[model samples]
Structures are given as C-alpha cells and as structure tokens.
Target chain A: MTRFAFTVEFDGRPFMGWQRQAHGPSVQQAIEDAIASVTSEAVAVHAAGRTDAGVHGIAMRAHADIAKEIAPFRLMEALNARLRPDPVAILACEAVADDWHARFSCTGRSYVYRIVNRRAPLTWENGLAWRVIQPLDAAAMHGAAQVLVGLHDFTTFRSVHCQSASPVKTLDRLSVEREGDRVSIHAAARSFLHHQVRSMVGCLAMVGMGRWSADDLRAALEARDRAALALNAPPDGLYFVRATYPGES
Target chain B: MTRFAFTVEFDGRPFMGWQRQAHGPSVQQAIEDAIASVTSEAVAVHAAGRTDAGVHGIAMRAHADIAKEIAPFRLMEALNARLRPDPVAILACEAVADDWHARFSCTGRSYVYRIVNRRAPLTWENGLAWRVIQPLDAAAMHGAAQVLVGLHDFTTFRSVHCQSASPVKTLDRLSVEREGDRVSIHAAARSFLHHQVRSMVGCLAMVGMGRWSADDLRAALEARDRAALALNAPPDGLYFVRATYPGES
Candidate 1:
C-alpha cells in the first residue's frame, strides 16, 4: 500500500472539529468518505492535530494509505471533486514512505487567533473571527505573552478533556500584533496541549483589556490548576496554520 | 422625519441582490425588515448602487428616513441585534441632511474584484472569491487595464438590462494589483453601467491568461457592441467597496 500525505484546508463551521465523530460530521470523515468514493476502501485519514469545533485549518497535514495506483495530483483533484458542497479541499498530495505518520512524525505546529477589534458586528467575517467590542492594547498583550514562551507547566491553560499525560510543554513562540482594527495572536510549539493556545490567548486578551497584568499571567501559569485559568477563548477565532515535519521548510 | 445614513456591510451569498425583488431575499429587504422591527415603520431605504446577486459590500452607503427620534448609535445597535443570524451588519451610522441621497448625491463609486489564482478549491473563502486555475499574468492585465481609464462609450461592456441614459462614461481608475496568489482589480468611477465592472474584469482576465491581448481589449471597447465583449466575470468576485460623496474624506 502506498501512503499519501495530503495538505488539507477546511472551514470549521460545519464540521465537528478534525477527528471522526459518530454524533456529528467531521473533517476526517469527510476526507475519508471522499477517499472511499475514489478507492472504494474504508480508509482512515489521520491528521497532525485535532481542532475544536468552529476552528479553521489552513494547511492541516494528513495522511492515508491506499492500494489504488493513482497519481498524487489526480488523487487531489478527485478528492476535491468529491469533497464538493463541503467546505474542505485537498490542497496538495504526494506519495510518502509507508513509515511516515501524519500525527506521530510531526515536529512542530503553529496556530493563529484572529480578533476583530471592533464594536460593530461582523459581516463577511462573522464566523471566521472573534469580535471584541473593547479596544485591545496589542502591545501589552504582546509583552505579556513573552512570559509564556518557554518551558513550563501549562496545566492551568490546558483543557479539562486533554489526554496528555503531562502538562509540561515547551512553547517556542507567542506574539500578538495589531493591524488596522484586527488583533492577531501567533503561537508555535513542538506540541501543544489541548486548549493550551486558546487558554493562553484568553488570559492575554485580559491583559490587553487592562483587566489582568503580566504578573497575573505568570501567577496563573505557576498555579498549575485549571481553576486558575482566567478564561478560555472560544474556538471561533482559532486556526491551525501549519504542521512542520523533519527536514521540511 | 430625520434622515439617517448608514455604512452597511454584508455577504451577498444569501441575497438576490441589493435591491428588493418580488422573489428571493435581498440585502435591502433584510435591512428594511430590521428597521421596521426597530421603529414600526415600513421605511424605504435607498442605496448608493444596486449589486447583483452574490456581490459583497464592504462599506456600502445607504440611507433611510424614520419618524422616530432615535440616536444613530442606538439605531445601529438595535438594527444589529435584530439582523442577527443574517450575514449583514451596520458598520457605521450617522445623521444626514434631508437633501442627501444615497444614489443621486454619490460622487464616486469603487469596486474590487478578487481572483484566487490557484488550482486548489477554496475552503474558508468559498462564495467570497472567484478561483481561476490557469496561471495569470497580473502585470500584463494591469498594463492593459490603463487603456479603459479614459472617457469612452462602453456599450461593449454594458449589460443588456442596464438603464443608464448613455453608455459614455469616464472611468477614473482601473488598476489591477496582485499580492501573492490573489489578484485584485480595483475600479473607480462617478458611475458605472450595469455589469460594467464584471464585464471589464472578465475581459482583463482573458488578457491575463494570454487568450486575448491589450489590442484585442481595446478593439472590443472601440467596437462599442456588447457582442464583442470577451466574457462577463461572475458576481462572486465583485465587491461594492466604497461610495464617495462631496466633502467626504
């Protein structure tokens, strides 16, 4: 069987996150269904990361094994045609070694949180971004985010449902910037605990609003208790930007 | 009655167009319904220009006269609350003189057409941008766009349903810009005949694809016959960007 690595992009409004679920439609199921339609085999697609509902994926890395002899470009085209009417697309596909795994072999992950810093209700960006009526001091948020950019116990910022055995993870980058009226937060790490990015962003937004200080953010991180979390940002503004593998740009 | 002018924004995917229709939903109807729900009046709202179905508006200028004495802020808030679940928003609102008309008093209009020059199907930007599979020469398109800037009889680009008194109009600007994979065509003029922007964009795209040349585009324009037009771009990529008025920045 030839293993194919696919770069997937999807709108998270309709799917129940990235993984397959019995209760509702998921991005994984949609891609697997499309692959099945193409190969007639019940193939399971694996993703680099699992996103929450309403979270967008710009270049999510995924893989599936198929015995059918189809070119990567043709497979991408065929999958795109089958995924039609659904807000999902197979951006790129390439043959990979059978040993390559989408999730286990991933080395780094990046995410961005978009905030429309305006009081006016969203129109075209309704579900794509989070609307914040209060003006945000992006500089302050950026300064405060620096404290979370090293190895630490992120238990307070992790999800209650997170399955990671240890909340200790090394965060590579956390920066906030504002352009025009939109504030964006960028985070990168080797691996992120469930809801870690969103939780950190929520506390940083508090800092931006002058409700919490950088000291508070540091104190919360030291607490190591989920109850110490100031807030958990909604899934609407989150986006999976990229997944990097070894020796790849 | 007090005249309140609004800067509206909406995703045109759900609407038939900007104007009220006997059948299908319209942005005008959605705003009107919200206003009636707020003030209990069947008020008539006028827009700077009417867009075709699936054409978006970023800061569309419109106005309505209401007998109720309500602050612009309150009116905007009410309308937003009432227009909820619909992909429309009141970005700005202000009191205008009774003499000001959204359509007649507008001095200039701006439109932008977005083309995603890629083979991958759109995900988050579905219904928001037009995707072109062929590689486009944006610089060539931009060079060719300058020829249509001067005053000319644009009969070749005017729609059959256009009700303008004359086809002769001066195009102040028609510039094509490309940032990465997105090619944007910006057009500005005092007024435009129906389908003028889309038709011009369609022909420009043909020029960009090397199917047509700058000379061909000029020949079609000089022919002054609608039959000579190369193509008509779909409404999906068209956006009513802004409406300029006298004494406005």
Candidate 2:
C-alpha cells in the first residue's frame, strides 16, 4: 500500500461542509469519489482541517491510500479531470511514509476572514466577503485581537458542538490589517476548536464597530464561559488557508 | 420638471447591460422602475456610459427627471430601498440643473480591469476576476501599454458597432500594476470608443505572457484595423469605476 498526500483547493459554497453528512454533498465525498474514479480504490481521506459550510479552502492538505503505483503529479491531473463542475481542484500530490497522517502530522493551521466595509453593495465580491455598511475601527480590532495570542483556556470562543477534548489551545498568531475598504483577519495556531476563528471574529467585529472595548475582550477571555463571547461570524467570510507540517517547508 | 444627477453601484451579473432592453432586465430598467416606484414618476434615466453585458459599475453617474420636488438624499434612499434583491444601489444623489446630462457633462472616465495570475482556480473571486493560469509580466505589459496612452486614432481597438462619430480620442492614463497575484489595468480618458478597455486588456495580456513584444503592440496600433489586434477580453472583468465632472470634488 502507498500513502499519498494531496494539497486541495475548493469553493465550499456548494457543499454542506468538509465532512460527509446525511443531508447534502461534502468536500471529502467529492475527493473520495474522484479517487475511486481514477484509481478504482475506495479510500477514506483524512483532511488537516474540516471546514464548515460556505467556508472556502485555499491549500487544504489531505492523505489517502491507494494500491496502484502512479506518479504523484499524474494522480493530481487524473483526479482534477474527473472532478468536473464541482469547483474543487487537486493542486499538488506527493508520496509520503505510512506514518504521515494528514490530520495528526499537521503542526499548525492558518485561516483568513475577509470583511468589505463600505456603504455600497458588494458587486463582484457578493458572496465572498462579509459586508459591513458602517465604518469599522480596524486599529482597535487589531489591538484587541492581540490579547488572545497566547496559551489560554479559550472556553468563551469554542463552539458548543466542538469535539475537542480540551478548550485550552495555544494561539500562535492573531493579526488584523486594513487596506482600503477591506479588512482581513489572519489567525494561526497548532489547532483550533470548531468555530473558534468565527467566534473570535465576532468579538473583534464588536471592537471594530465600537460596541465593545479592548478590556471587554480580555474580560471575556478571563470569564471562560461561552455566553461571555459574541455570536459567531457568518461562515461565508471564512477560509481555511493552509496547514504546516514538520520538516515540510 | 426637476433633474437629479446620482451616482450608482451594481452587481452586473443579473442584468443584460446598462441600457434598457425589452428582452431581459437591465441596470437602466432597474433604476427606472425604482424611481417610478418612489415618486410615481415615469422617468427615463441616462447613464454616463452604456456598459455591455456582465460589465460592473462602481460609480456610474446618471440623470433623471421628476415631476415632484423630492430631496436628493431622500430620493437616493427611496430608490435603493426598491432595488433590493437586484443588487443595484444609488450611492448619492443631488439636484442639478435641467440642462445637466450624465453622458455629456462628464469630463473624465476611469476604468479598472482585474486579472488573477495564479495556478489554482479562483475560489473567492470567481466571476469578479479574469483568472490567467500562467504568470504575467506586469512590467512588460506596462511598457507595451504606455505606447497607447496619448492622442491617437484608436481604430485598431474600436468595436465594429461603436457609435462614436470620430475614432480620435485622447487617452490620459493607461497604467498596469501588479500586487501579488492580482494584475490591474487602469485607464483614464475624456472619452473612449466602445470596447476600448477590453481590447487593450487583450493586447496587454499577450505582452504580459511574453507571447507578444512591445514592437508587436506598436505594429498592431499602427495597422489602424480592428482585426490587427488580438481577441477582445471578456466584458465580465471590466468595471466602469468612476467619472469626474467639472467642479466636483
């Protein structure tokens, strides 16, 4: 058996989410079907992160097992050819050792959220951005976001349905930057609980809209209760950007 | 009768074009419907530029006549309220002299064309940008673009159906800039022949991909024939960004 890893890109608007559900289509099911079409092998692919509905992925990492002996790049080409009209593409493929699990081997993950702050309706970026008609204070949001950039019990930000064993996760980076009418929030960590990024963005938005102060965010972190945090931002604005692995620069 | 001049924004995917058409919906018809809904006035709105199918307008200026005395800002709000699911909006409105014409009073027009140069398929910016898989040479394209940025008879780039009385128009600016994966072509002029922006982008794209040289562009322009240029790029990636009028800030 050969273990192969793949980097994927997808527009998640059509799928229910990354995971398979009884209701609708999923990103994993699409890849699994494509793998079967190319290699005639039914393999369960493991992704580095399982994104939610309407959330996009730029370079998602996944791993699968196949019995056939094929070149890595050729496998990518075959899979992409079969995955037509789905808005998903296999960016790159590589052979890896059996011990390299897509989820377990990932050391860090990064995500970006886009916000279009303008009075006019979004033309080209209608579904891709979170539109905020009023002006936002990006500097204040950035200053408030810095307070959550360390090891802490992120109980207030974790989703109620999150399956993580513990709420204590080390957040390595959290930054916000503004360019013209767009504001981007970038977050990185070893791993994050489900809906954590969206939850934090909700709080940051409060600071941006002058509804909450920096001290309020710090207080929410210290409270360690979900009710102390703001509502989760919409999934349409979120993106699972990429994942990092050891010795894989 | 009172005349009002207004700035508008719209997502052009749903409309046939800026002009009112009998077969399908259009930006002009949408605004006209909204204006009649607001003031019970049967109005005909004239735009600064009549864009083609799938062309977006960021700040399209238009003028309409109303029988009732309505506040400019209130007229803007009323029209926008009626244009809700269609994604058309009136950004600003002001009462102007009855002689003011949106198409003739404009002193300058500016446009932007977006090109996404990358290998992966566009997820967030699918319809908003022109995705070119190969890497682009922005400097080369810019060098070639400067050759057309002055007073000239642009017959080589004019559309066959263009209604301009003369092909001679002064181009004030034609610049290309690259930021990461996005290559933007900006053009400014007092007036332009139809399809000028799309035709220029098609020529610039060839120079950007190293398929055509600077001298090739000069030869095409010198040919003074429409067929001398390459294919006209799609109208979906074109945006009429703004128009400047005399004594307006």
TM-scores of chain A across the candidates, in order, are 0.99, 0.98
- TM-score on alpha carbons, each prediction: 0.97, 0.93
lDDT of 2 at B209: 90
lDDT of 2 by residue, B140-202 (tens): 999999999999889999999999999899999999999977899999999989999999999
Best lDDT among the predictions, by candidate number? 1
Superposition TM-score, candidate 1 onto the true structure: 0.97
Report the Cα lDDT for residue A70, model 2: 92
Complex DockQ per candidate: 0.76, 0.44
DockQ of 2: 0.44
* Tens-digit per-residue lDDT, B16-129, candidate 1: 999999999999999999999999999999999999999999989999999999999999999999998888899899999999999999999999999999898998898898
